[model samples]
Target: MYFEKIDSLNDLKKLSIEQLKILADEMREVLLLKLSSHGGHIGPNLGTVELIIAMHYVFNSPIDQFVFDVSHQSYVHKMLTGRKQSFLEARHYDDVSGFTNPDESEHDLFCIGHTSTSISLACGLMKARDLRQEKNNIVAVIGDGSLSGGEAYEGMNNVVEVGTNMIVIVNDNEMSIAENHGGIYQNLKLLRDSKGKAECNFFEALGFEYFYIENGHDMNELVTTLKKVKDVEHPVVVHVHTIKGKGFKFAEENKEMYHAGPPFDRKSGKYIYPLDNPESYPAVTAAFLMEQIKKNPKVAVLNSGTPGGFGMNAEWRKEAGSQYIDVGIAEEHAVAMASGMAKNGVVPVLNVYSTFLQRAYDQLSQDLCINENPAVILVYLASVYGMNDKTHVGIFDIVMLGNMPNIVYLAPTCVEEHFAMLKWAMTQREHPVAIRVPAKEFISSGKEDTTDYNKLNKFAVTRHGRDVAIIALGDFYTIGRDVADKLKAECNMDVTLINPKFISGLDTALLDSLKKDHKLVVTLEDGVLEGGFGQKIASYYGTSDMKVKNYGIKNSFPDRYNVEELLIENGITVEKIAEDMEKIIG
Candidate 1:
């Protein structure tokens, strides 16, 4: 009722503190009402309502930059930034992205979904503004869960060292997709419980001006604290304490469930989809790893701050004991730490998403790949496009990981291959392996795997077709299969389908065995086209007499469109492939 009259941020900013508190309540109700139908990160957004309002009211957005780490909390930002109506009726519509998108609104400085990137991006924006001689302040709103990320630490360390004029708001609601892990949680708890007094001084240790506030939900305190921090001359970290799922009883009870989700019953707090057959990578992977760690005492599991997000459960912690170490969200430390753990005789398995893996690229290349540490990096949602508008498109890992020496890239199209690769990767003692597990369903078969992947550079051919060769990478194999089936059934053309399980070291044997009669070779991957697996294929066929076309995501993407449409637009079409093959043969 309050927000109905309040259409703009200006109207919101004009409200009194009492009115602002009530506005937060109204916004929470509105969000729960809308998202119950569409499903979203209601708990995180609900908890952030007041803080987002305070940020908008105090800081001039679209001019003064605001970056939300993981960006799930941006739902309140979206409401205040004038995308509320789109959120209500047409939620899944292209206009209202789930994450922050600079293109969507200047209010959303960055479109990011992954964790631990706010500080780095914010620091970059600040530096860019300085180079251009711009005067606007750059603010990064990161959560305690995000602060666990090594990139955030590196970014904060860099920002502090350089002594820039910026505001880093630490939204310490004490959760990151799931209950956070590592020493930071203990430190955050200590500081959060501090009533208007400072404790631990974590950021202060990093050469940052630190200010800790007790209650982030209190609009007066939030605004007042922010105003005080904004007056400071150097880069500072403002630690604000807030509740996760502050209002909703169910969300408060189950903070993890409400982290980010689809629509649910507001009163019941139960999800629209019953907890049966949930589509999750972490749970599946963690469940399987528990089985492995039980069998092999030497096998261990690692996570950044996302132990819970990556599906590390209490049973594993209880059973595996110290074998399961959540390295916080510090991906760089997690990777290097896993390498060290392996050097000491433990087979460490690091479960991380492909996008977040970018933060530890240098460590992955220099520390593990160079020395050939035999650690297993299980990458979920690899080569991803727009799952959410957040800064988490993991489309670059395939291109990046494949080129790294002494590292094997395994793209498992289904669950059997997924678990199979996981098992194989854990036992290896020579080279580091990164498995690309796409967010598609698992194709499970009861068949046991007795195969040894000593030579990981191999491709699996699903079908034997003569006209055209469709080289599919990772989960993109399924999409290519659909295209191949369309070519076979619709146009009666036999299309060869090859799943290059190994992304980096392509099967030169398979490529060498290609027949001249098999006229057209099309490579399909889910990563960026340039410097991606498809381009690698184009490079493979560059000097040869083979005709090649590369298909994947192109250069820059900042919008939500049909995934199938994206493939078609990129020329990985069923009809187009059929027509091209027919022409080539004729």
Candidate 2:
């Protein structure tokens, strides 16, 4: 009920420490109820309740800008800043995004979902404030896990140059999406053990005045610590050692699983929604990698910081032993390392989310693609169906990777194709191959994919027909199949359905052959239309007599979009395609 009085940060000024503590509990209750009903980043939100409360208590928001790393932990901040209904009520859960968006609130400085850019963003704000000759506090709240990223260090190194009012709050939760990895984590542990009295301090070494809070959950202590550095003339790092999943017992015990999860039972902490098909592309790829690594000493599986999400669980990772490598929130390093491994006759399969892979574009282009390294890069969640956020949209990977030369990017339609392509990419030594794994539920085509990838840019004609030729790339094969079936049944015309597995290049020979019988050529791809697979087809047939139509998502960031509705909106459904075919044929 104390949370009811909190319409803005000014409301926190009136509350006593005891009242603030009470408000934290009420806010947690709301968070628990909302997260339990609808899936969200539960652990981060629950753990940061006190920190956010203290932040509101100390800093003047809108004036004092706060940039959260990853922004998953900003749920508590949202609740305090006139968005309580989003967390408190079930109906209002869809009102706000899972990440911090400037469109949502004036308190939010940036639309951030990806990790480890807080310090840099805050530094920019500090510079802008300085340019305006204004005096206000700027804070960047980052987690211990995010420190493993090169950008965080880059930001920290540059932040010292400002020499003005800046505060970097390090929320030492001791975990990323998975358990923390890399040498920086070891130093963090040392700093935590030393109780801020250590001789070797990373923050201090970076020219930041360091202060550590042993009990980050304590409201009085956090407020006192924050207040001390609120008006500090120079940059400071307030290292707050806090529990990741502090209040909830389930989250405390299983930290990784609780980091983000689906709608679950409040009492039992069991998932309310059941996974219809648990056999995922990641699981299949993990199994294949485990088998390959066990047999071939030269084979290795690599992931940045997220092994569990990519399907290499603790057991599988242990089984992998020395063969498995987690570079720890460093995608750039992982890409570079994979390229190195490939150069030395080792086949390194690097699996990372498509959105996260955006960080290592330069590494992918220069280190791997330019060198033509044979490293197998598995791009997970590279469709419109992947994580729907402005910062984490997986639709742009096709545009990014496909543009790079000497990089063979393949999109697999089914589990068989995926594994087959994986096996080929692992063993081959021609080029750096990246496969866009489908975000849709994994399905077996029941037929073995024995297509020799050595014959690059060769499309497979699943069905041969007349009048219209449909080229479906990767995950859009199912839609293409349905369209073909509808065209045959309704229009009494069979259409040629082609599965162009390769996105990096067009099967121009096969495309030219289609001009004989096919009057209209249609391409379907599950990504943004611009700079995507469909665009390549449209470009190829630009001046040709064959009328080419490309169907795909537009070049826009859609937040938490409905998959079916999005498909319909993009004219990707069988009904829409069939109607188009009828019109074209007529």
> Could you say which candidate leads in lDDT?
2
Q: Model 2, 1-586: lDDT tens per residue?
A: 8888777778788999999999888888888888887888988988899999999888899788999999989998888888988877778888998888888899998999888899999999999999999999999999988988999998988889878989999999888877888888878889899988899998899899999998888998998899899999999999999998888889888888888889888678677775323487777778778889989999988999888777787788889999999988899999999999999999999999999999999999899888998999999888888888778889988899888899999998998898889889887899999999988867898999999999999999999987899998888888999998887887678889999899899888998898888899999988899888888888888888898888999889877888899989888899988898788768
Model 1, total clashes? 14
Candidate 1 per-residue lDDT, tens place, 358-438, comes to 888899998998888899998866754335233566677877898888898888776777777887888778888888876
Model 2 worst lDDT run, 10 consecutive residues: 269-278
Alpha-carbon TM-score of each model against the true structure: 0.89, 0.98
Model 2 TM-score on a 0 to 1 scale: 0.98
Q: Which stretches of candidate 1 lie over 4 Å from their true place?
A: 60-65, 88-94, 120-138, 158-165, 196-200, 206-210, 234-236, 274-284, 308-310, 383-390, 445-451, 465-467, 479-495
RMSD (Å) per prediction: 3.2, 1.3
Clashes of each: 14, 0
